[model samples]
Target: MTASPEQIEIALESKAWPFQEAQKLVERLKKFGNPKGYVLFETGYGPSGLPHIGTFGEVLRTTMVRHAFEFISDVPTRLIAFSDDMDGFRKVPGNLPNQDMLQQHLGLPLTQVPDPFGTHESFAHHNNDRLCKFLDSFGFDYEFKSATEAYKSGEMDVTLLCMLEHYDKIMRVILPTLGEERQKTYSPFLPICPRTGRVLQVPILERDLAAGTVTYRDEETGKLVEVPVTGGHCKAQWKADWAMRWVALGVDYEMAGKDLIESVKLSSAIARILGAQPPEGFNYELFLDENGQKISKSKGNGLSMEDWLRYGTPESLALYMFQSPRKAKKLYFDVIPKAVDDYLTSLAAFPEQEGKEKYGNPVWHIHSGTPPREELPVSFSLLLNLVSASNAHDKETLWGYISAYAPDIRAEDHPLLDKLVEYALVYYEDFVKPTKKYRAPTATEIAALEDLIRELEALPEDAAAGEFQTAVFSVGKAHHYENLRDWFRALYEILLGQQQGPRMGSFIALYGRDKTIDLIRKAIENPRV
Candidate 1:
């Protein structure tokens, strides 16, 4: 349901990162006079390299902001996942196949480079397919548009003509920003070399506004050529291309990394120069790698989309993307477990959280409107620990422990938990296969175990969950262990053979009070952890 503007403004103010971005978007929409029909949000992809996590992050965050606009304005909205495939292949990637073949098409646009993988028409199209495939796997709602098709089909022709009409004016805005050497040869438009079929960034010999043609010397062959600034014959330089797309598409919102602050600023200026206000934009911080280096498609430092999904669920990846846009965080494999647990934990709270709190949650935005049918009986972390302890070969064994812990849940009811069981068991074997290092328990540990057994046995079976928890805590305190964390850690190490496990009381209550007593007694009687 669409919320009133006033209601959205109040809700946005409560939890926005960097505060007021959503409000600013709302205000920008209110003040916007040129276009009054629809709200258009755009995200860009440069298919020169394989799409990475940053690509995923941009689309996910853009979707979040897009949802905010939809909730507030009720305007018709479209998200364009635009690919700059017409961008020149300046360098070959280190990770991809056929580096030497890519080197052969160095100056040509990515759309012209032969596909090294041979699955698509060209290198750029292959990456584009990869991007679309990955996003489709997550069910993103977006329209994919390519620069090659946009220009060739005359979709951006009017924008190109306007840029040509204001060429000298736009050049003045961009030239000063370039270095001394670049300033000497910069032209707003990079004409595709008609002879060589390569994109040529050359000094403009002349431009005729009446003819809508630019004459330039080829960067490669030095042969002078004249081509219409419109059509597929030419494309604007990177910064100019950005401005043209905005005016052409009437975009309302977009976002980029902080490194593009200057680029965004410059593009906004050029957009106004070409007779349209720039789209409202958010400059988010970049994701860094383990070494604090900014994660790049070239560096290949961050985990691929395949790696992330293999290790965790799409919801977890979405949660990782759902954090404050301005906060720079490391995206490594180690973050997967917490992200998975966090998604499950947040989901488990949705049915219980109050009106404002429920609406304020990221999962609400992550789902666009409705949250998942959250029936997660256990977190992925706790399940992994249980899987490790039980040496669970399949879901049946894990289900035995899980059902006892959550008696009301059925194996078929919670599909997310069923999925987690599969992921958790594999993850346990690969990442958390702990050695069984049972040791002689100290007298104090033995005494604490005895007290725990006695307390659990005396508890009424119909006791509230809090009552069960209190009984366990009381036993820990009775053994002179006031720190529940320390006491719990001892129990985990002794019983589960790990440094941690699920909440002790909850685990005991679910695994059956009687079964827990037998396990603790076995440890105490054998003097073995």
Candidate 2:
């Protein structure tokens, strides 16, 4: 069950999340060999807004480990995802239809956000439903729990009593960490006021279960208040309360983003004091934007899972999830097409025996998980242009091109090629928006391209690679272009209406003389000016 040296090396090289810790856990499990105890994994949904890609990424990786454990041993594993709808709304995330509506739902259970989408009763429910759909799309089978349901069932009553019993211990940990006096009197837990979207100090003053109303008070101004407490725990203070609940619920493993690493560390200490087994932890980094900013639902700065799917299949997205989440990495919207193509190519080339031997199983783990290799057969744009220009939409044409040009690939590998074609189709659909046609090149640009085309044509048949490179460079020098890069840029601009693209010579060689010339002519006619 322990990972082989090659597996450990790959994990380290890839910097997979909990890279070292996962190895350790695997080794531990191998030693224990399916202990007569439950293996549990936990994830949470804040119900703040549309759950972002990061949320899916966390759960998917957790599922990977859970499956790994199941495959390696006979232990039964439980993956539980809790929707923390009981948590109070902190702010209205961007892309929401109504900010005012969210404010009105403040201080209320998240299950009550007035659904801006109008399909669900509340914003919290809307997001929770979306998360469920997303999880289902990714093939995760999990036990779902709602905070509202857990609280009403008195599942947390003992935990709540425990918190009350250790109120001082909670204060000691919370107050020093909070840095605000107002927070001192605040119960570690508070309910959201449905009318204001503000955190109420305590939503329940005196409960009239039969009437479904509770007497309440405003913490800030000592104003008497009342609100309906139909069901559910009002709110659990995040971080501190979250830590307590994890221990109370017996979470065996949970993956989290880097931002919460310190909080989880502190929570683990608290869990120990409460005589609860702290869950094994995996800390991961966030995906960033093209400008190197963190992608966040609150920030609204990056692509959503839905956005990605426009150009990528669920499997491609899953491969993206398989990437190590240890380092903060940016996912540029423009770069995804090529990345998806590369992932498909890698999947095609995946070493099946290597995967089985390394993981100690015959499962299709590599195909089912992991990002494709970094190198791609060609740039996505180039492939799309070839396919479009040839009007060859069939899988055979696609496979033929791969077999002919990408010698590293084989036609016998049609299964992986089919995946690539599917991925390419999705990419074309998502990113190929209608734009103005390419414009005709000016006299000087046309003259420049013609001269370079002549020089390339005049190269001796079976010319050395170096000689071919020099012939192209000579055109740039004659045209007063500073370098070969300048010549290529001008050629691309004239031919493709872009400053640069895939390597021109390699592109031409792959597509053949007639097809390349025809495509270049087409590009000239439909210049994307």
Candidate 3:
């Protein structure tokens, strides 16, 4: 069958991970269309505290799928970044304001709890506002929904009644999965204690389905109170609420971390019993730290979205989110520079790439099929080290090294580099400046260093960065250094007097071939004491 140009584009995109997910979504839509005239994709958040990198991840990945969906189908789509602010606040985050004030509100709904920081109405509101702010900064297009608002407005009332109607059936599905003690008095409904304003999971004394109310005996006072099953009077257990949300919102697709596999399965079953088919979903593995442990807020070990943006760009972070999500990967401060490099590499090659390879480029996904065409004059890591070597205090000073290395480069040519210079300066101050080191080369290392200096002297002053780079590589091979690392170390320690620096070729090109040779000779003749 002959395919349309749009179909060909989508088919190319279909080869990628998230786009592949979107293509699957299109296929499913053909099987069963949403009667609502649009496909809904949801990614949920728990606003117990501040949003993290993982929060950015889910929304970004879902948006990629949405972008891919647009390439394939004409169906309208919406992404719901729903926040579960209705959930109880069980723990006080060490990072938030007024820790002493939070303890009094523990076990109440997060939206009902006061914001210790005094910024928003509550902790949940503060976090939700922050989530919107961050996503807006990245220019994300999404619909933000608050669970508290959704429930308080009686939007989930029908689903709430459905849960009440099938309370016995829902319990049968949930009880066996629990420990014996938890099974004794557990009910699917968690009512906000009328006296104390805390969401309580107490024994369900009875349900008046016709009246749309549930009577639950409070554990604290042993008094049974009746409240409407909806309108924020009642909240379901997480598994039950997940199903209820699906049925209420008509979510067609959602993705969650691999840790929620059981939760997703249980929610799917409950959703079926509640009279709506569960949304199709992908359970991806969670991000890990350097030690392969899960990145945790309490541990304070994972890189924050703020941290990533302070030192990295939104595009690099977007590319990081676009990588193999089902496979667990380490996300840390050290990973940022490489992610930046990989993003640049894809941009440089994007013009020539075709077919699936073109669609598969992370840049293509990062930019939603329109990646930046202009490439940076030098890689970010190279620029960072160059900044260190030359004491570049601003863009002009940094451009000095950049212009020297690539003489044709103009300050007006690269706008991305200008933004990057700001990030690199802040990054250097925070991560690099404290550990700055300078050491003379060992007597054994000096001979190889001198040989490299002679090679640099022979290279023409007009040599290109790549040509000078080749000369540096040849010198390393000739001297039988273990590898380039050893040779580069010699250059850094003996000349720049640091354990590591930028690529010697580019550094030499910018630092001047004559000055480089002169410095090496001076070091050899009068070794640093």
Candidate 4:
């Protein structure tokens, strides 16, 4: 729904990142008239490898801002998922087969190289197809723009000629930043070899502004050749290409990783030099791997979209992308459960929110102000614990417990909860089960467990979580567990076989009081370690 003027005013005062970004776009439109009659939000992709989780994040976050902008402004908006397929194939990725064949085509444009996977016409096409499929699966409303197509089809000719006209100025802006060796050869324009089809990084020996061409020495023949800066003849270096693309496409907004802050600055400067405003940008912190190292597409070390989706819902992954975007966070399997639960928390809170509070909620932006009303009675984390405790191998086993706990909630009623049951089973078997280490409780813990069993026995079978929590708290306090945390830890470590666990009251209520007592008895009688 389009936000009313009152809601727009509220959104202007709202602290949500997407709304703040949308407000900036509004100011920009007010300052410089929207010539195209629409705001363009772009997310660039380097088709050197398969699109990774970071790639999804940039587009997802950009889409969020675009949605927010739609809410506040009457102007239409477009999101372009741009691919840099005109870039040179610098190195063979480690993951693909036929590395030797890839090595043979190393210096050529990505679109000119043969597909190693034998899936598409070229390496870039293969990755680009994967990228399109990736974004399509997420149902992102976007237009795909290829760098090669943009260059070859004359879409970038105006910007190319403009850069050629300001060659000296562009050089002045770029040369000072490069090393002496790089400075000697760095040209804003990279010419495609007429013979071999490789993009050349040679120095511009001369510029013909009238002809809109740059003269360069061809490395293969050692002869100076002049090529038109327009059409498929030349492409700009990455920094310049980024700026040129912004002006050529009239991009109003784009975002990148924090590592590209310097790059963004250079691109913005180049965009200004090219006589257009650079897009409003958000520099988000990069994701880290399980080891806390920066996630690299080449390294293939962090969680892939496939990996996350294998055990978490799409909404959960979207939540991970939504929360604290500027803060660096480890993206791995361990973070999935919390992300899922956090999404649930936000989804649950959305209905109660009023005015700007609704705008502040991530789900409002996530679903474009019409977030679904589906309710999840249990969190993803709690379901995982239930899987661990019950040794559940299928959703049916979980539904038995879920039905017992919330008798009113049917599997048909809570489809998301039903899916979570399946995800929990897979997560437990794959990630949680192998890592589980249960140890025999000490005499103090045993006594505490015995007291807890007595309390449980006193309560009715249909006791609520609060009552179970009160009983557990009383038992811990009576047993003189100084920290009380140690008592809870004992419960988790001994019964659940993991360091972290769900709230005991909820887990016990869901898993059944009698079943929990049986688990504690089994733990007390056995030496699991």
Candidate 5:
């Protein structure tokens, strides 16, 4: 459905970061006439390693801002998923095969290096294909741009020459940031060695702006050589290349990791020197691993996109990216269940939200303002717990329990829940099962359990989860537990065999009254599992 003008106005005033970012572009359109007829949003990838969660976060976040912009203003937008394949292969990644083959190709443009996987024409092509496939799976609308093609096709010629014209000024912005030694050899351009096919970072002897060429001394042989800055013969240094990309592509908005704040500022300065406004930018916090270490694609320490999707729905992964983008969070298996539940909760709430409140909803932003109306019968967390207690080996086993809980809800009717059941089984087998530890019930806990069994016995088989909850609360209170959390903790540790679990009432209601009694009786009989 098309958003009403009133809804658009609410979106314009929305405090959500995506809307706030979209507003920046709206202001940019006002300040500088968008001569391109459309605003350009770009997310860049360096094809040195395979695509990771960080890559997904960038494109997903940029896509969110793009969607927000569409709501507020009617200006057409284009997103370019740009790859810096022309970048020199600095070092071989630790994970990929053929380390020796890759080591020999260091300093060559990534596209020029042979594919270690032997899957594509070149190393960069292999990684880029993986990236495109990953993004395609998520249905992100973007045009892929290759730095090699942009340079070789003469698309960046104008900006390449413009950088040459403002060399002294661009160097002035960059040189101060480098150490004294780096400043001595630092030129804005990195020339491709004609003989060796390596991108050489040598000091420029002279530059001819008219010819768009830089002359430099070859490190391999003590001889002067000249290469055109255009036609893929030379690529600019990191900071200069980033700035040039903005001007060359007419990028209006792009976001970077918080670690790149200084790089953004430097590149912005170079963009201004090249006579174009720098793209409106955002600095989002980086994702850390379980140990609070920053996630690196090469390090392979954090969860992969494949890993997340294997155990959780894509919407859940998207929700994880949406929340607290500027605040650091751990990206690991433990975070999956919460993210999944959060997505469901937000999605379920979208239908009832009023005007401005609707604009603030994450589901609204998640689905680009037209969130679907499907109601999830069970949360991802509850499904995980259900899988744990039943030791469900397949979706059919899970469906048996879900069918009893919501008889009208069929697997065919609720496809999302069906997928969740499959994910729950996989997650339970991989993560939950191995670490689960069941401890013996103490005398006091045994007494509480026996009382709880009696309470369940008194209640009808058709009793609601809330009714079961009240009865369980009465048992805990009657036991005179010091704190309510301790009671829940004891229940989880004893019954679920995990440190945490879904609400007992709901679990009991889904698992059935007799089965829960059996589970408790077994816990009382056996000290450990």
Candidate 6:
């Protein structure tokens, strides 16, 4: 049964983290006439390179909140995703080919840096465009704001002035935050000059808003550096500017990675001094690599959203994102299939009344609110082969086949079959496509292969399920199989031609008698020498 929309809302509200910081922001907003009926969420992007899964997680959670609000309230909700393309290049991502180009473009606005791929005009634009495509694919309704565009429109001038007015306070916060070495060389902010391709040192000067010019004396050399600022093109110092921008933009809530918690806290203090409301903030943990290290573009350990989409469906990806962001976790390719299965199960658990609502249904809301089950789909490669070979069209038939052979999947009450099927299709299209041409197996792996086949053949075809499982185990023992570990290793080598596959009985059952036999025969015939 599916859940009703009201129930889903209740479920979501029930799961909402009691964000003390957000509650404070909400209370402060009440002073501004309760703002009538709108929830605003902001997500920022640095156009350094390919947007990782972490980026998707941030926006996706924001979208979840927006939906929850729409479900529970009569007022509209808006989410804005801003790309910081105007920021200067700190370091070129490792994936890029030319390190020399980055050096040439160092200290220049990202908008001016040349694209390593030569596909886009600038590195920042390339990544920003890629991120935009990813967001659209996921159906996130977000207004895209480019830092370049925001600055050019004079929208940030007031915020810039606010930072300059409190420059001493900003410097105090910034200097102590940086290491002593960096503090010696660093200015409060580095404003990029497009014409000169240099970071123009902006000093304290009388603001001439009428002429759009600022005059300042260089702190280091005591030399005067005066420049005419273009209406759309002045830069702000990193920390001070960041706080000012949030208040100026009226962001209600934002989520940051664990690394930025300290920085955002300092920004909050700046917001109070400026009498501007700071956005509600949550710090989510990072997505780690299979090696258990933080996934980073610089380290070349991060996976792109596009790459992950190739291996799993968007919703399955959403399930991955829904996994506890507070805990440090590793997400490997092997984990996606189970995520799909779990999502489907969650969807199935909803009562029918909740399913009828198109948006904001209580069942879905609850499902969204909870953490995904620890179990994920069997494996993408295994599922691809099963789907490729199966005659079944719907999830129910496929799962029915799975339940027939796998005792773990309870036939009567499992709700996630539809969700599993959706994930299967995506897995096939994305990850499976590249592997379609590979033959099943060869003679090099035939000993382990033959042993598994011989054992399966020895089991009585008409035997009861438990009895069949017992016979299969007995055969492994007779053959002196080290454990289920060695047995599965042999099975996977024979079936999928790899080191692993889905649970054996469930996989065979899902593939059906004819297809399973055919695959085994193919493996025997084409054994890799």
User: For every model shown, what is its TM-score relative to the native structure?
Assistant: 0.89, 0.74, 0.93, 0.98, 0.98, 0.72
Question: lDDT: which candidate is best?
Answer: 5
lDDT (C-alpha) at residue 89 in model 4: 91
lDDT of 2: 0.64
| Runs off by more than 4 Å, candidate 1 | 4-10, 16-22, 34-36, 219-221, 434-472, 475-484, 493-500, 511-529
Winner on TM-score (4 vs 6): 4
Q: Model 6 lDDT vs. the true structure?
A: 0.64
- Model 1 TM-score relative to the real fold: 0.89
lDDT (10s digit) by residue, model 5, range 309-409: 99998889999999999999999999999998999999898888887777888888788878888886678888888888887898898899989988999
lDDT of 4 by residue, 1-529 (tens): 6778998888767699998998899999999999999999999999888779999999999999998888888899899999999999998878788989999998899999999989789999998998889889989999999999999999999888998888788889988899999998899889888888888888889888888888988776888898899988998999999999999999999999999999999999999999999999899999999899999887788998899999999988988899999999999999999988988899999899887788888888778778999777688889989988998888889999999998899988778888888899988899999999988899988898999999999999889998999999999999998898888888889998888788889888999999998998888887577
Every candidate's lDDT: 0.82, 0.64, 0.83, 0.90, 0.91, 0.64
**Candidate 6 residue lDDT tens string, 32-142:** 644536667899887776677888788987676555555444445578898888877877777778888787888677888888889998888888888888889766789
What's the true lDDT of residue 352 in model 2?
47
Model 2 agreement with the true structure over 424-489: per-residue lDDT tens digits: 655544444232134566676666666655765676444444555576667668878766676676
Off by over 4 Å in 4: none
The C-alpha stretches of model 2 lying farther than 4 A from their native spots are 1-19, 26-36, 191-199, 202-234, 352-381, 385-490, 503-506, 509-512, 518-529
The all-Cα superposition gives candidate 4 an RMSD in Å to the true structure of 1.1
Clashing pairs in 5: none
Candidate 1 lDDT: 0.82
RMSD of each: 3.2, 6.3, 2.6, 1.1, 1.1, 7.3
On the 0 to 100 scale, the lDDT of residue 518 in model 5 is 89
Give a tens-digit lDDT track for model 1, residues 405-448: 67888868878788888888777776677454566667888887
Residues 1-529, candidate 3: write the lDDT tens digits. 2236775575555478876787778778888766989889999999997888998899999888888777767788899999999999999987776888999899999998998879889889998999999999998899999999999998999899999999999999999899999998798888988898898877788899999998977666777789888899888889999999999999999998999999999999999999887887887889998788997664556888898988898899998888888899999887887888878888899999877788788887788788878766677877777666656678888777667767777767777877777777777777776776656667766777677777777779867777778888887888777777878777777665567677777767766788677777777887554
